[model samples]
Target chain A: MILRPQLQDIKIIGQYSGRVILGLGLLMLIPLLVAVCLGEHAAALDFVIAASFCLSAGYVLILICFTHKEPTWKHGMVIVSLSWLLAMFFGAVPLYLSRHWGGYLDACFDAMSGFATTGLTLVQDLDHLSFAHNMWRHLTMYIGGQGIMIVAITFLVRGAGSALPVYVGEARDEKVLPNVVQTARFIWLVSLVYLLVGTLALSVTAFSSGVPAVKSFFHGLWVAMAAWDTGGFAPQSQNILYYHNFTFELITISLMLLGSLNFRLHYALWAGKRKEIFRNIETVSFFISIMLLFGLTAFGLASAGSYPGVSSLFRKGFYQVISAHTGTGYMTIHPLQFVGEWRALSLMGVILCMAMGAGACSTAGGIKILRIGVIFRALLEDIKRTMLPRSAVVMDKIHHIKDIVLGEKLLRQVALITLAYIFLYLLGTLAGIALGYPLKLALFESVSAGANVGLSCGITRPSMPAALKITYIFQMWAGRLEFVSVFALLGTIIALVRGK
Target chain B: MIGKNFVKIWLVFLGISTEIMMTVFIMLCALGISWLISGGWR
Candidate 1:
């Protein structure tokens, strides 16, 4: 493994460059194979053409430049950041070669959306999309959601310094074990097992219920990807609502719940320590919050008389609740239906669920579960202190199995960041409302996009105002990393350009 | 906060996969070029 310490001081950049060049040559085959196997000769040729250019450039860099045995933090960050950038560069080749995009940035945006699992689209027509393109889009979601970085940690390298920080950067907090590679292996195993199980289960249910076997399998494929990674990429243009079946809705909801629970819980369950499974504060908070928020949304929907049938209400209500809470963003009901008909409180409820996001070390976005647990615990301590006598001084502590951490700093950081997230949410909302979108619809779309909750009101579309699209894209990127990583990326870039 | 060092390490690792993809891309192209030089498909 080549470790780049500090950005500019990347050691072994020359040595490993050849290996990287070699690796790129190999990975370009998957989709190419898929294209050929699927009988899409044009797609195959397109991929072949794009593959050549990228491979050639990568080889030149690897063979000519220095790749040392060590890379500093700066170098590692530079490499990783540049790597994703380069991925977007190389990834765009397929999209551009297909002649689907007008400009490379647009292609990059679409590729990033897929790789980031943001699910938002710039594709002008979903109904008319080529099969190869469709397959590629979903495949990117599956890859990105499992995480391209964690894939590397699991597949290519086995080291602490290289894996730990990178794993965290991929938006995971390792709880089941200390070793990053071990944690990565555990996560991948759990996810793969779940994916296999989920795909089979959904496929059978969908098939038995009358959908064609092939269609059912594809549905299973995309939904499994979305549910496991908490990515909201739907197989059909209509999203989850396309099925509109109670059985399908129930199956998706179950998958979403399974995926949103923290991976630590899975580890504990696997280890046969049943007691450790539920004791994690994040798990408890997630369930409690789900019950409270879901009940609130259901109540709002019921009261609105939006669904004449009880079944219809449950279909829309439960799906939206799970969708928002998990930050999976797969909507069962169109935002057009919910507008004005649904009250402000219900919208707020949905938004709050999205803002909380999935548990740590999971693909779902937003503020995450552990930080919420921290802030909630901190709040409880403050209330208790107020209830006590004036002379009382309270020492706050949060305990995990490893140790009891007692400090106001961690709580403060969590609270401040959560607050900042809300502020950003508001800014996005105001930007939309200011741009002539109706009051409620604009806020809903902005919050939905900003929170990485794939739900949207009437305003979100391929032809959405370009300014609005830019806002949503920023929101998606910022929300996916919870603001901090993006800031880190910015700082690193600035430091590299100016500090050197 | 999003740790820069952590995300960087991740990116480097992910790049490995991308690197693999890039490598694979080259192979296919090489095959295509060879096939063309070998008299294109008869």
Candidate 2:
């Protein structure tokens, strides 16, 4: 018996949900083949289970919930948010059930790390991992960065209204093109271009560093995805320091900024809007924050004598600054250095940078700078109104896509949400501190997790207390979707419990 | 017409990003040059 969900409720799951899940399942097939090729019986078996689960799950969902109704904006958010949650949940299976990893929590942590493009890992010895496994890990970041939903939209059978929420939930709601599918297409193309250029450069650097061709090729692909997504997963057990070359660091830095940028800027460029580079407020803020934070951090680190010379001073400080600011989470230096010395001032700069996060639609996660800009513009409006007489009235406004959006109510809503972000941060930190971790370490871990920055001061380990792990997981979820979608989920739950 | 506008805007933005890319290129060259002058990596 087919139970037709209400048309409204069906669209709430997003358009073509089954096809998208099938695609995710199909993506697993390649890794399954690779595992089979390597003759890793256990790994192949794991993929077989995962793929079957995804296929059947996708098939059932499609068969049961086939609806002609189009997705509205509200449905788009619900479906996209929940779809990611579902994908992450099912996606964790291969890692979770394998004989290699013991705990379910750790497996989910690893899978969420991959999907969220957060580089935090709980794996003890990455050296023992098979090549096929590492490649699968890299592929997860690649798919997650561009978004599997956006891929669904780009090839969507019904194109009219399907692109809006897919684009919006994929985090690129700002219309660079009139059609959202075109915007999504343009994003893929730009990413491909960067991937080609970035991989070649990184490959050359790695090869010159005496890394083998096979190692260079695989590592190059891994770094490209990680850096391009503002993700910090390193191919080596030691992360980026495995190469330990300044040139390698420089290459990764450039890629992180490129990945952190909104695709609209790229689209605008492809269309010959040279001024869009300067006109982009998010890009401007990203650079300004990097510079200001880098300057202060380098000075403080140098004064503290963390490194010997000025070049090395700029080198270490700038990389860490970008890693944190972009939420890429790669670290070349010991966290102990950042932790023990320059605690108050350095951490302040670092924390503020992580909170600012990356471009709106880009893979880098957190509250996002565009929303922050909206909040800032709102504050300025308040200040101006304070100085003006009672009779005077003001309109709040913000700039985007070469136009102004004027609405005080919208601005107030954004500001309120930003305040909510701060509260979430403090709450996570307190939870960790209350559980018996050092105060500073707890605060750092909370911000890192909450911002999805993925850089641990070495505090989060396999041995970390269970209560702390739970805290970090919630932070990662809240940070990745931003607080709005989580709040929306909470509201839905509340409504069901209270009313229905 | 919208597609045309989108193309024009993208190309113009691309041109500016080219300059930004060039700045990065030049800076990278400087790093290599100074490294060479300083007798290469330690």
DockQ of each: 0.01, 0.21
Instruction: Report RMSD (Å) for each prediction in the order shown.
Output: 13.9, 4.9
List model 1 lDDT by residue over B1-42, tens digit each: 469777754653453333234323433433343333233366
lDDT by candidate, in order shown: 0.66, 0.72
Model 1 has fnat of: 0.00
lDDT of 2 at A484: 57
User: Model 1, residue A139: displacement in angstroms?
Assistant: 2.0
- TM-score of structure candidate 2: 0.87
Residues A212-255, model 2: lDDT tens digits: 99779778888998888887878777788788898888888888
Lowest-scoring 10 consecutive residues by lDDT in candidate 2 chain A? A1-10
Error of 2 at A395 (Å): 7.3
**How much is A42 displaced in model 2, in angstroms?**
3.8
